[model samples]
Target chain A: MKENNSFILGIKHGIPICLGYLSVSFAFGIFAVGSGLSVIEALLISMFNLTSAGQLAAVPIITGGGGIPELALAQLIINLRYSLMSVTLSQKLGKTVSALDRFWIGFGITDEIFAVSTSKNKSVGRKYMFGLILTPYAGWSLGTLLGSVAGNILPDSVSSALGIAIYGMFIAIVLPTVKKHLPTALCVVGAIAIGCAFKYIPMLSRVPDGFVIIIAAVVASMVAALLSPVSDEESEQTDEKEVNTDA
Target chain B: MPSMNFFFHLGVMAGITYLVRMLPLVLVNKKIRNRFLLSFLYYVPYAVLSVMTVPAIFYATSSPWSALAGFVIAMILAFFEKSLLTVAIFSSAAVFVTEFLLPIIQ
Candidate 1:
């Protein structure tokens, strides 16, 4: 009964994540198809790779016939942050959570899951974490499937317009926190400025989009972390713990 | 797209990404008490999302102008802390309308 309740709780909390992913992944689906992935390919991509940044970023590179190493490298850099989240969450799960549950649940620990799970002052159990990840997982997959199918049907002009959906989703995820937090706000501006520099500067322009994202994220984040290291007490809410920006 | 290469990339991307998550979860059984690393990890999401949004967004629309309009619309919605889906839908709709109206005016 308790497991079921937490499962339900996870779904309840995950509803917004599901809803948001449905549209953002819709954009990804269309973007994937627009970039030449088959509908099934797009769906599978969403299924296999749940996060938005790496999967969506990989599409252009993959479609352009980039190599396995390039794709692997992109996944590593983009998703590496999750490692920190996983470690953070692992402590929350604690010794009570079995090794088996820990392994499986880690798969679901995206930004939102981490944020929501960590937000609980009490330690989170296996069931709650599983429950939390479920809705967003379904939402992500379902949205991608729909988007892939829709991509085949939508006209180019409209599909092109829809392309902004992914970025819009990113903005919605980050903008609120950036507004509330000065360090986070600086981090956004700094990342964008670096990203733009890579694009316009002649020498840096040759860098692949994948490399550029990795470099910008790492460098800007490192700087911000130095400038504004959170006291240990304020860290949990500072997440990262959501699709709220967690995923 | 060649099936062989596609699957290869998929396998590698999924494999490495999974390892990234799994290692930390399974291995790091103890809680991190370190302030410095904790602070750094906290900033990761904001940085990642920010870098991912730009340059690429410019090309997601029929025109850069349309994308910019959508971005502006999204920023406004997000500033007021609207739901994610609301921000995305409204912004995309804004982009679609801008795209549609542009050719007529131009």
Candidate 2:
């Protein structure tokens, strides 16, 4: 009965995440197809890899004929922050989550899932984790499937507008926090400045898109860390705010 | 577009992403004590997402102006703490409207 209850609660919590992912992944579906990937390939990509930013970054590299090393490095850099979330979430696991269950649970630890699970007052268990992950996974894959299919049929004017949907989502994720938090606002500003330099400067503009993201992210994050180190207590508050960022 | 090569590349990307998530939860039993590292990780999503959004967003639509309109709408909605879907949809709508009107205005 207890197991069933947590599972239900997990599903309830996950519904919102699932709904949010539907739109974002729908945009991803359209973007991937617009970028020349077959609809099935886009669907397969979403099903196999649930990382939104990671997959978004990967599509360009894949379509551009980037090599294995470049694609690997791009995924690693773009998705590396999940490691931190996974590490943090590991501490919240209950005894019901055995060592083996860690691997399964880890697969579902996107930014939103990690936030949802960790925000719970009780320790997360295997059943609860499974229940929580299932809905969002379905929503993500389904959204992509729908969007990719629609991409082929949607008019160019509409599809072109849809291209900004993902970026709009990103801005939505980053800007709200910027209003409330100083370090985050500064970090975003600094990163955008660096990003602009890479996009416009004659010499630096030659750097590939993959490397530019790496440099901008690493340098800005390192600077923020050095300038405004967040203490453990402070980190907890940030985690609460993270519920809105990734989905 | 080669079937075998596409599958191979897809596997590599998915494999690397899975390993990044899995390795940490499986290996790290204790909380990381490094404050600097933790801070860096905390700020990483912001940095990376911001870098990806800007300049690129400006080019996401048919015209930079339309993209900017979408971006501005997104930022305003986000500033007011609108839901993610609301912001995203409205931003796209803003772009659509801007693109439709740009020709007449020009």
Candidate 3:
């Protein structure tokens, strides 16, 4: 019964994430193909990367004949947050999960997946985690393939409108959290300040956009964590109950 | 058909991406037992989201003045806890109208 509940919860949580992934991946697919990649190549990239920003950043670089080192560096810088996320999620998994399960779970760790999974009860089992990953994984890949193929047929106006969907999904994720958390509010201000600073500062404005996000995330998270540590009581109250129903 | 170069590039990207994502899960699964680290992870998503979103509100426009108008409108709507879809649409619309009408009126 407990297992069933977790499975259901995973599916439920995946719904909004899947919707967002579809729209975003669709746009990515269209843009990628339009940028000169074939439909199959676009599909494969989206399937493996499953990251919007990382792929978007790579598109121009790849098309421009940027070296492998440059592409790898850009992806690494943009995706460094996943390392922090994996460390946190590791604790939530406790000591029960096997290395194999962790392997699969890590493959699905996108910004959306990390956000949704981390927001859930910590004692969630590997089975549910699998469910969450599987649904969105399919949605994102399929959306990419379809969008890439559709790019040839779709009108330019429609494709451009779909491009905006990714930004809309991003805003959706941020708004609800800022409404609830003061530290989050501070982080938002810090991010905007950092973004503006990077844009306007004489030397900084020349840095790549992907690096800016990584720098902003690390600086803002560190500052917010230092300024407002999570209280012991709140942590305890939010402690997820571990139900060992697998046996 | 896609060029061989495109396929090779795509394959390289896929390999690199999978490694970055998979490395932490494998490494940390064996070593991480710190409670402080766990708490830090809990807040990372919100921080990352904010970092990604706030800049878009301003950068969505072509000109500084138009972006300023969009930012003002977006902030007001966001303060009221409007849906992000609503805020983005209204703000983009605000930029378009402001930029479009400014010229006509002037």
Candidate 4:
């Protein structure tokens, strides 16, 4: 009964993620089809990969006649955050979780999934994670299929307008956190400075987009973490407990 | 006009993508606890996001000057803690208007 309740909670929590994924994946599908991919091909890509940024980045590389190595490197750099997310989540899951469960859960470690999962109380278990993954996975895959089929039906202007949705989503993700954390605000400024420098400086401008992103992220994160060290007293208080399971 | 090769290319892309996604999971041991590493990991997403979004403020526009105007509008909206949807629409509209009106005025 407890397991069933956890599973239900997972599904309920996944609702917002599913809705967001549907809209974004639909846009991606339309863009992919507009870029000359067929419906099946687009749907297949979204289904298997489920990474909007990587997909967007890959689309241009593929179309621009970039080689396989270029595509792989671009994707590696763009989605490297997933590696961090996976590691943090594994620690959160702890010892009792089976290997097979970890395998399946690892597959669903997208930004939204990690956000929702980590935000949950420690009491939440693998069942809940599985349920959360199910709905968004379906929404993303199906939305891509639908959008691919519906491509070119909409006016180019409207399609171009919809291009802002992903940016809107990014703003939604970052703004709230930045408002609460001064370090985050500093990181944002640092990123802007670094990005602008890369764009304008002749030496940095020669660097590839993927490499630039990786470098900027690493440097900004390092600086932010260094400048705002967490207080040891607060860390000690939190570390005393195994996991705060209270929701 | 997607050719059969398109599907083949996508398949290759998917394979490569999955390999990248699966690597850290297979490699990173769950028991390892490095405070410095964890702290670094915590801020990565935010840094990556800022890096990605900051450039788009300029790249999305037709000209750098016009994009700067739009970016100013965005920064103002962001400073005031405006809604994301509102900020996005306002910033893009600012760019569109700037791009549209600048030539006429000049």
Q: Quick one: best DockQ, which candidate?
A: 2
Using Cα atoms, each model's DockQ against the true complex is: 0.71, 0.77, 0.33, 0.37
TM-score of chain B of 1: 0.91
**DockQ of candidate 4?**
0.37
Best by lDDT: 2
Candidate 2 residue runs with Cα over 4 Å from true position: A1-5, A244-247
Q: For candidate 1, write residues A1-247 as lDDT tens digits.
A: 1222366777788887677677778888988888899988898788887888889779978888766666777788788878888887776774447888877887787776677777666677766777788888998998888888888898877787777888887888788888888888898899999999999999999888877787888888889888888876556555542345423
lDDT of 1 by residue, B1-106 (tens): 5497778888788778788998989888777777767777777767878888887788777788898899899999989878777888899899989989999999
Name the lDDT value of residue A2 in candidate 4.
22
lDDT of 3 by residue, A1-247 (tens): 1222266777777776776567668767877776677788788788778877678767766777766766776677566657766766666664445778787788888766665666555555776787778788888898898888887787653444343444444555455556766777787788768877887799998766555666776677677767776654443333221000000
**Better model by TM-score, 2 or 3?**
2
DockQ-based CAPRI category assigned to the predicted complex of candidate 1: medium
Greater lDDT among 1 and 3 belongs to 1
What's the CA error at residue A1 for candidate 2, in Å?
18
lDDT of 2: 0.87
lDDT of 4 by residue, A135-239 (tens): 889989987987777676765544444444445545655666577668778887887789779978998897666556667877888887787754433222322
Candidate 4, residue A161: the lDDT equals 44
Cα RMSD over interface residues, candidate 3: 5.5
> Counting only residues 3 or more apart in sequence or on different chains, how many pairs clash (N, Cα, C under 3 Å) in candidate 3?
0
Query: How displaced is residue B78 in candidate 3, in Å?
Result: 5.2
Which runs in model 3 stand beyond 4 Å of their true positions? A1-16, A30-39, A63-70, A84-101, A111-130, A146-160, A231-247, B1-13, B27-106
